[model samples]
Target chain A: MTTSPTERNGWSGDGALTDMAASVPKAARKTSRLAGPASTAEQWPEFEAVAQPQLQGAAVRRLAGRRSNNGVGSSNSSSSANIGNNPSKRRWPRVVLIVAAALVVVALLLVAFAACSISRGESSFEGLMANAVIETGANAVSYDEGKTVYYNGHTYVLNEDMVSVLVIGIDRKESAAEDKPVQADAVIVVALDKKTGQATAISIPRDSMVEIGRYADGGYAGVETAQLCLSYGYGDGYETSCEYTTTAVSRTLYNMPINYYFTMDQAGIGPMNDAIGGVTLTPLQTIPKTQIVEGQETTLLGTDAYNYLRWRDKTVLTSSLDRQDRQIQYVKAFAKKTLGAAKSDPGLALSLYNQVSSYSITNMGMDEFSYLASVVMGGNITGLDVISLPGEMVQGEKYAEFYLDKTAVYETILDVYYTQVD
Target chain B: MTSEQPPTTSNPDPKVPVVRKYRRTIAALTVLLVVLLLSASGGIGWLIWEHNQREKAAQELAETPIPTVEQPVASTPDTPEVALPDNPIDFASIQQTSPDVYAWIYIPGTPINYPVVQHPNDDFFYIDHNPERNYAFEGSIFTEMANSLDFSDPITVIYGHNMHDETMFSTLHYFEDADFFAENDEMIIYTPGHILTYRIISAYQYDNRHILNSYDFSNPEVLADYQEYVRNPDSLLVNTRDVPLTSTDKIVQLSTCMTVQNWNRYLVNGVLIDDHLTN
Candidate 1:
């Protein structure tokens, strides 16, 4: 082939043709290889059909030769093949364009797929509600069931979007005897409405009589109506105790759902109190038995907050109730200070939660804490109302029993949980 | 045996012939690139159109006026049941759209106003079908055959999609906020001749267990246990009231999907607190 080009062009030597082939700038060589012959239109088809495959083969060999040269700096005989590989370079950009376009299509598909998945999940939600008419042998009300309850000639619905949690203050610490059952010193049901920023705490005196399941050796014993504090004594003094107490409170409070329990021993009060600097308030009453003086303005530190909560005169039958009033006062002040600090420092709530965790056991997770914190902080809550359950402390044979007023319980449940439906 | 290259120093022929030879191949490659380029843009356009369709459906439903039930004449005072005020609603128009639609639900302070339907044959038919019975991404608010159309069951569970567009029950998440739950506590369900108002008791995340299938509401003990679970759910994200839920109390549980956890559903439970006779 090299000799034929020299003879046809009337060149004197074969070296001249090789030099000319090599000297054709790489871009020109791309076309020159295919340009040979075809001076006449009649020969063009014949030349193209036979030349396409050979040109492709030459391009492929040239690439291999170039790669080898880079790797081993080897001298190869395929130098002439390299001159015809300009077409490969011209096609590189097109290949990249196709790939980029395909990627764009794929990315759009992924986004659309994500959006459809959300709708798909929502549409796939299946519900379980049975229409089977089964007679439960109970008298049916004359009006629409479940939607409205007629109470005292008034119709009311459960207030929308209300949240309630049971805050239990234990009488004993973790170091106490494992076998011995402990009492819940303070039982409070705190309800919060994030929208209204309205929060109320219903304090259940430890001695309130309620039905609680009695557990013996982790087995369920028969339920007994006893002082509410005794419910804590029925369990292993941890989760079981809280569960028992929650059931008792729920039953006593007209079966109100009291989820979210946070049980803390008496020892947690100090660290909790000190976490927000300290709680300052005027003493509500004089307690001669302890350092808490009546009608005196005081800022309580760690142990001071502990004394304000723990000291109850054993002589008086109503001493626990009196202590409860002061405990409510202290809690209100402490919470006010803590939440106020939390408004400025978002981490304050978590830090306070962590500080009390050593002496506390709770079903609340970090999400719950953050949820409540955000609610309390973002809500327009003026202050938390500390309410004492209206009850009469009666002298029993050996211990004092606080019997909650049924009407009061009903009224409280209505005021806190129900909205008038007119 | 054909090729001869001209000397680089004195090249006589022009390059135009070479370019002319490959013109058809270049044209084919150009066509392919254009097709690929068009497909990429077309894919994006299809997605936008799909999203617009979903939004259009939602917007149409939102624009539909909630029909009001006309109040009947004075009833017996001894009955302790009062008649509601006349709110004229062309319920006939609503029924015309779908005979399956039996009730209307309205929650103030949230975008939950919509007609409630029950597919007689398939419990899940309305899940992906609109009130017009057309296929829609945002399904209609529906109930299964497990519940009566009159809302008389001890527990009536209503199902809706938690659409990302916040058109369906997605706004139910408002109740997750304490302030929203407290301020907006009542929801109204209007049947043919009666207006029912339910008191929102609690808004909490619950397991995806079918309430009707999981418990026999016909059994008083089972109903009591289920009611207890409703009042005192084990979920961490919860907002509850001090309201009591008894086995005799007829409650409506609005169920939707949770955003974070697919296996769990967010429930806004309401107990029947008010019922008014309407024409």
Candidate 2:
């Protein structure tokens, strides 16, 4: 209530009084726009000091008229008559209004509460829909907002766009033969980045000493370090075996989440090769020219495709490591040719999937299948990046064990972690 | 109420009685306003209570325990070789009260524990019918007539209302967060002999189309093309797996209405990765 010098002097000087009068009207106009009881009373004292000498009655009537016009009127005539004249009048109507307003505000708040509760009852999906439906019209919502495990004290949230797949080439002729026992000859951890359209395969040689998980019932039985490929033998040739194999590979890489697993027996290869139309591989090693010889880009179809992938001559293809490189070449070629054809025809990639699905047992359903197809069909068949898990070829009793180089394995995973593809 | 009457035979200006009559009218109007305000508050309170009841019912049903039967082969066996739980859901007991209850769908991370229904002839039968078979605004989760009741289709498109209250398939929107979609890729559908597991591949807002009626699944070209289409979905803001899809795959689509630009349908898709049959 501290008065400015100009407002204080207005009681005496004529010009000052005129200036005060002008400001008072502006104040009164402002008072009408604001709510609450104290505002109207605050404006009256200045008005009374200047005008009460002659214009008291007119001011009172004007006050009543404006109050009614603003819709904050009361039916009490006594309060209306006394409004501009009395600075401290005990009015019951004001009390009534305050109570009514408080009630209204409470009701409104409750109504809002009920609305939120109702929306909370809707599923998160419906909320998104309702938000879009309602907010889109207003154009107001800002949308901001995994097998994942913590390794070495750092948490790596499993990337939704990233997936690790265990591709097991069961040592059987053709793909559908899972009834009898078979060994997983070729074990490769294929990692794909759908975002950058890049694929990397880290081949796990059969002899790496790693913990292979076994499942007793639906539970993880235990982990045993043996020849990396023997984990496949722990399960009785059904869903159990696939589960165990997936775990073995996942654990080998510090428990990376394996999103899906696919077991392809020998039977699946020919159809798969044909499914992708045909795959052409550049020779990583020469088979010493026997017609379709060494250092040549081999376009493989049917049985030849399988042979090129599984070939290992001590004099030519040489070792299991050599065979793995051929497999990687086959995969990269298959992806490039299939994905390339998909750009023009669109159905070629899916057709390939359908053609080969019968021989393979995988954990990928339609949605997973769709996303895979979608990423591949993304055009631009650049080049495939393949790396074999670095290891030492140690001489074992019967066969040699490719002792995994721990440092190299970690570096490869980090490469996948930080590497970005265009 | 004030009883102000007019003058019978006034010898004066007649303004006095008129004033009294106006005061009476004002009094009557004030009384009417109070009643209206009270009634409106009461109505809103009732709506809140009703919504809570529906949620309570849904919770009760989900928590109702698969009611000990001859035990559908123990769920978690001591060893991997032991038989996994595979028994048909007791549809007979569920249908005794509501014939609509058929299969049940459960997702661990999201709020998606509910009974699913199938109408043999009508696609929209359960769009307005509750699990209790009552005509409620929040409908039950239902698949269209275009899909086989056995869920044998390569793509079984299921539908449910997008209620403002999270009653039906509305929770499917939980997949909007790519992490939720990735961490919880498994979708379990309990059927007669098999417990089918589907990995969620893509979750995004899609155009409103009668999927089963629109696409000819029998055509390898159509099937193949659709697989690719879902891969590069129109608006995949959240998530997608980099898995390769072939036409030989089996997919089940969970479809619901989305209110967005042009108000279309939002779809969460899953592919059948593995199936464990029961004894």
lDDT for each candidate structure: 0.65, 0.57
Q: Chain A only: TM-score of every candidate? A: 0.65, 0.57
lDDT of 2 by residue, B155-188 (tens): 8877665544444666676676655676778787
Ten-residue region with minimum lDDT total, candidate 1 chain B: B1-10
lDDT of 1: 0.65
Task: Show where candidate 1 strays beyond 4 Å.
Answer: A1-147, A173-180, A288-290, B1-279
Model 1: DockQ against the native?
0.02
